[model samples]
Target: MKIEIWSDVMCPFCYIGKNNFEQALEKLPFKNEVEIEWKSFQLDPTLDASKPQSTIEYFKEKKGFPAEQASQMIAQVAQMGKGAGIDFNFEKALVINTFAAHKLLHLAKKHGKSSEMEEALFKAHFTDGKNVGDVEELISLAEKTGIDNDEARRALTSDEFNYEINQDIQEAKNNGISSVPFFVLNGKYAVSGAQPAEVFADALQQTYKETASPFKDLSQNGGASCDTDGCSI
Candidate 1:
């Protein structure tokens, strides 16, 4: 079974959803058979990476939210994150383009370190307040996640994984996904937003049951010779 999660490092709910889904995985009986793939997403693709701005300012200036309202909003998200074991420092989270981070994620995916890379990126952005768009910082994060530093450097230096990153985004669009923290279970079950762990667990259990071996094809006959209502003789 495959569970693909579309998320952006800048999304507070994405982090919470990740935590919830991981927790859900822990209680799942078929967890070992399930593979979790983290897909790339960018909250603000047009933002200039060179100009660093705090997340608070981004919400205030970019979104045109009042200071008090923005602070309250961040506080609400922070409280939710704390409940899910995340320490979100929205006050200092630097707002920058995540395209490079997403690119590095694809490299990590090749190494089977995509989840690790996602964790490192989220920690760097939400907790340590690092600029995620910087290549040097991304290389360091990749290294921390067990990706070779030199290889990571090369992948970042060149325009690598840009297509994969865009493809993930396009896939999301094709799937009618208009937001981050969207999860697709077995390519059939769609769970949106940062739902509770129980919700995730339920979705997993349901999908597993629906696709379980009990429903396997056991016919001796091939039953594979028909096309356009014409049987292959």
Candidate 2:
């Protein structure tokens, strides 16, 4: 079974959702049989990478949230994250373009380290308050995930995985997805949101059970066959 997750590095719910999904996979019996693919999705593709802004400021100035209500909204998300074992310091998170980080993810995928890269990026932005849009910051995080630093820099400087990122976005559009942390199981079942662990566990169990096929033995046993007995003497 395959699980594809479309998420943004700066999205708080994406971090929480990742925790929930990981917990679910841990409890699932068929967890070893499942492969997780992290797909790219930018919550703010047009965000200016030159200037940095705090989440509260971005919400109030860019998204038009009232100054007073921004913290409240972020607090609600933080509280929700607590339940999923994520310490989301959204107050310090930066509002910047995630395209470069997404490209690094594509590189990580080729090296079988996509999940590690994803976790590092999320923690870098939401927990440690690192600028994920910055190539140096991204390279540092990539190094921690066992990615080659020089190659990572190359990927960031050049136009690598640009089409891969766009394809993921186009696929999201085709699937009618407009949210971060969106999940698709076997390309058939969809789960959208930072749901609880049990919800994800149930989906995994149900999908694995439903897709299982019955065993069949259609081979012939020759002219004569017997179990621990002589035949056709």
Candidate 3:
């Protein structure tokens, strides 16, 4: 089965949904057979890459919530992350443009470490409060994730993966996706929002049965995929 997820790195719910979806995958019997793709979606396209703001202030301004309410909201999200075995430090987070980060993600995908790089970027931005929009910082992150610094720099400066990211965003718009953490299963099933692990698990299993169970014969199709019919013999 193939699962395509459209999300933004700066979006808190995107990371939350990531953790939840990962847990759900772990519970599935065909976890190893599942192919997952992370598509780019920017929440702040107009954000200046040169100067990023602090997470708390950004949240306050965006939500029009008071400081106390914003803090409580962060606390609530942190509590939820704790349950998913993640440590989120919303106090130290940076609110920046995620377009470059998404570009690097496609580069990482070429190196077969897209998911690892994504997790590292999320932690660096949300927990360590690193400036994700900075090229040097991003290069450092890529190097830490086993990608070469030169490759990272090249990707940062080049327009190589920018088109891919834009394509994802455009496709999401075409699919009527107005939110982050949108999951599309086998192009036939879609689940939105940062749902609980159980919810994701249910979606995965249900989609799996809907797509995989009926096509148990693998010899004819050899596991190759189709858009709507899935892999069929």
Per-residue lDDT tens digits of candidate 3, residues 1-233? 99999989998788889998998899888999898899999998988899888767887887688888888888998988888777898878888888889878998999988889889999999889899999999999999999999989999999989889989999999999999889999899998998999999998898988776665554754554666756553
Q: Evaluate all candidate structures by whole-model CA lDDT and list the values in order.
A: 0.89, 0.90, 0.88
Error of 2 at 119 (Å): 0.5
Two-way lDDT contest, 1 vs 3, winner: 1
After superposing all C-alphas onto the true structure, candidate 1 shows an RMSD in angstroms of: 5.1
Q: Which stretches of candidate 1 lie over 4 Å from their true place?
A: 214-233
- The global Cα lDDT (0 to 1) of model 1 is 0.89
Clashing pairs in 3: none
By lDDT rank, best first, the candidates go: 2, 1, 3
Return the lDDT, model 2, position 216.
43
How does each model score on TM-score? 0.91, 0.90, 0.88
Error of 2 at 173 (Å): 0.5
- Residue pairs in collision within model 2: none
